[model samples]
Target: MTFENSLAFAQEQDKLDPLAHYRQQFHHPVINGQQVLYFTGNSLGLQPKSARDYINSELDEWAKWGVEGHFHGKNPWVSYHEILTPASAELVGANESEVVCMNSLTTNLHLLFVSFYQPDGKRFKIISEAKMFPSDRYLLETQVRHHGFDPDEAIIEIAPREGEFLLREQDILAAIEEHKDELALVFFGGVNYFTGQLFDMKTLTEAAHKAGALAGFDLAHAAGNVPLHLHDWNVDFAAWCSYKYLNGSAGNVAGIFVHDRHGNNTDIKRFGGWWGHDKERRFLMENNFQPMTGAEGWQISNAPVMGMAILKASLDIFAEAGMPRLRKKSLKLTAYLEYIFNQVVAMFPDYQLQIITPTEPEKRGCQLSIKLIGSDKKFFEALTQAGVIADFREPDVIRLSPTPLYNSFEDVYRFGETLRNLLSQSHH
Candidate 1:
């Protein structure tokens, strides 16, 4: 459990791991002709070895089938997004009908909001975390103003207690209690991008429901990294991109989950398109707007076959390993990284690497956000030059994510060793 044991234990655990072979399935990035120790799956996942083949299949069909590809091609383009449903629903713990792979993350967030964020005079407020991803904060702020409310009074931003890196569950619950009367909706990132803390979705959903509000999540960071039960948790809606931890390519399609409870609610008010029109009468060209059954009803454009192909390859890998097994491996891998970090901190009294992520695995995914005291951009740039692929957030945090599918225990060990060397040479 200690740093000294981590290196050996990681190696031994790798030897016994059934999923160890998966590491070889990704194409590791080569920097300056040397392989880098990549720990940034929190931002962009490595390409799966099968990604090329999967994508090529679609290209081949497009070339051979041409105009007929929409209906008659091998893996018909007309319903390509359908192929991803079974795997995506399984990954997110939703019923097959409740999930769909469609547009990008932020776009899906907007669509879901259109349906769920109806504000009235007394209940025209939104509650979200203070330091959300900039896009989310912007979107929510815009939504409040669109509904004719002042952003300052209508937006209930939840900040961490002073000196705390993450929000306590109790505080989040209390915030809901305090603002329950005016709160219209609760939208939060499933895991905080900066702090890498995973909120308790079940508790959050229950609290929001008890307060008579709709609860939704942006799972961009949590999606392939954490196990989610959108259905059981009664989450009204959620969205995520597949590029991170899912091994899909950058800008690949994102997915959405709408609870089965809302499947046929036509009064929800959505911005509709032909794809969302009922498939049976889709070509009838009648102007009457009849929506599809579940989350697929939210689609606005035709399926992007190329993007779905990449996601299919990635989902196939996830289906093989299953999340329960991957999460177990993930915990050990991240704990080893922390063990090494703790040792380095103890060895140098003046130097410090403070972990901003939650201490408990249940409250976080694979990422550990380390605030390097007295460190700067130069320090992070040096790590990149040294073939360590961790990401640097603005100000002082460095994020390292030891992805369970690809990162080894040795990777975490080497990163800590390199950081130790970097600190010892500093003029403290």
Candidate 2:
């Protein structure tokens, strides 16, 4: 397919897009009189227009029935989370029993580690990619310390070969094999937040199992952006935030996936709470904790109805769009974004911008992290002033994501146009 870097071409593509209508479902922010080209859905997704009604319904139920709202509301706060199970499961390719919407990202990671990241004497070290999201690093460092082990000794951080920006698959597998004897767990971001690199999850999970180590991923950037098969891949465990690509609202409830093997394991200990207990006996409130089967067994507290309501509104749209369709559109949309950037590069010629994200579509998602040559945050500020909503990582990377659900081909073309103008001005 020949790609065109023109407004007319973009509009034509948008006119033909099957997912184009979904854009109307979100509320875009206005800068002057026009809506800004939002590219930070990789951070906090745009709110679904229906979010208000979904949340207000919950508020209304609470106002009407007070405590009885738990069981009497239209959505039934008692089992509100169950409503999202099938769609949420479909989003990440897991069974309903294998996944659950629960605590926030790091909190869920800790909960998962409690059962999976146990460090015995012989196999105590954990391996992960270097320069991952800071939250994950902090979690790994503190988790190692909590187990009476020094982070420096217990954590192995893999980096790309010098002068490279992405991790080689072979290097990752080699590291896992090298440390197989001492490896207790292997964790990675499904789609790295800064680099936007989508790690090969299935192979990594296979390698971990071959090495007798638990494999898990922080899918904060990968969850809704990519089509995942967590259950079929035999991934041991995974955690993700809903706010990013899931479009579940800021600070929304996160999700977790525990494979059938572990989800069914009654012996695996977890941080128990009343919410995780069997629903039939939950009101009984026995002193003994009887864990619910599957990922639900890891829940720690009651559901946040408001957050889940906003999440439900977003999930409904996703269910309607379907992950396969979303993934298909995303690949083409993201590729066009890259193509536009390349066109800008040729036009500018003076700026040293290079896309740090992998050129391979399968190795990336919607984000294209550009390494802006010889520029800093001020460059990002310039783009922001021009109504660009991209994220700037320290040093020199501007991450622009053209989300298929909300962003149009016109949006991508306009962003490229804005960037070309900005870069040309900077050069002058």
Candidate 3:
């Protein structure tokens, strides 16, 4: 499909878009009495309009029933997290039993590591990409130290070749093979946060298993941004935040995925709480911990009702729109954004604007991470002042994610126009 860098063309495309109506479901931020052009779904998604009502419903229940809300209220607080299971599972292509909404992303990863990252004497090393999100880097570093291993020794980070922005697939596969003997885990972000490079998780999972190691992912950027099949990929476990593409509000509760095999193994070591205990025996308060089967077994506490309620509002939208359709629109939306970037680059031939994200649709999500040569945060500030909302990583990269759910083709085109104007002003 051909893309045009014109308002008329963009509007035409928007008119033709099957998912364009979804944009109405979200509350776009109004800056200086105008709606800002949002391109940071990779960071924080636009809030669903229904989120307020979702929270109020939960609030009203609590106000009416007090302690009895656990059993008497609509969507009982005791089993509230259960309401999120089906949509969360569907979002990541997992069995209902394999997924659960609980805790924050980093917290869930730590909990999962306890059960999956069992690094014994010889097989104590973990393989992961370099420049992982800081939270994940800290998690891995501390997890290694907890087991009395030096991070430099136990963590093998596969960095890109000199001066490159993306990790090579061959290099990643080779690293797994090279450390097969000592590798206890092969963990990665499903999509690199900085570069927006989507890893081939299925192939990576296969390589890890072949090397006799467990495979996992922190799907912070991938969970709702791209299509995933955690169960079919045979991923040992995975976790993600709900705020980004999942459209849950800031600091919303996160979720995790455990393959049926692992989830069914109630004997698996986990930091458990009463919420994870068998429902029939939970209130009885037995001394011995009787864990529930499936992903619920990993729950460390009761549900965060308000957060889950807000998440439920967004998940309902996802259920109505479905991943397949969302993914379809996402591919086209990103392709159009890349086309606009190319047009902007052509307009400013001397600006040295470079897209660091992979051009291939299969290797990336909606994010296009651009490297602005000879520019600083000022350039990003200028874009923001001009009403473009995007993400800036330190040094030079600017990430523009045109999410399918809320962002439109016109948004991409307008961004191109804003970028071109900025470049023109810089030269003057």
| Highest lDDT against the true fold, candidate | 3
Candidates' RMSD to native? 1.3, 0.9, 0.8
lDDT of 3 by residue, 1-428 (tens): 98888999999999999999989999999999878999999999999999999999989999999989999987999989999999999999999999999999999999999999998779999999999999999999999999999999999999999998899989999999999999999999999999999999999999999999999999999988899999998999999999999999898999999999999999998887898899888999888888899999898898989999999999999999998999999999999999988988887778888999998999999999999898889999999999999989999999999999999999999999998998899888
Error of 3 at 10 (Å): 0.5
Tens-place lDDT per residue, model 1, 165-246, is 8888888888899999988898999999999999999999999999999999999999889999999999999999999988
Instruction: Give TM-scores for every candidate, taking all chains together and pairing residue i with residue i.
Output: 0.97, 0.99, 0.99
| Stretches of model 1 off by over 4 angstroms after superposition | 1-8
TM-score of 3: 0.99
* lDDT of every predicted structure (CA atoms): 0.89, 0.93, 0.94
Poorest 10 consecutive residues of model 2 by lDDT?
A: 344-353
User: Per-residue error at 350 for model 1, in Å?
Assistant: 1.5
Model 2 over residues 44-93: C-alpha lDDT tens digits? 99999999999899999999999999899688899988898999899899
lDDT, model 2: 0.93
| Over 4 Å off, model 3 | none
Colliding residue pairs in candidate 1: none
Off by over 4 Å in 2: none
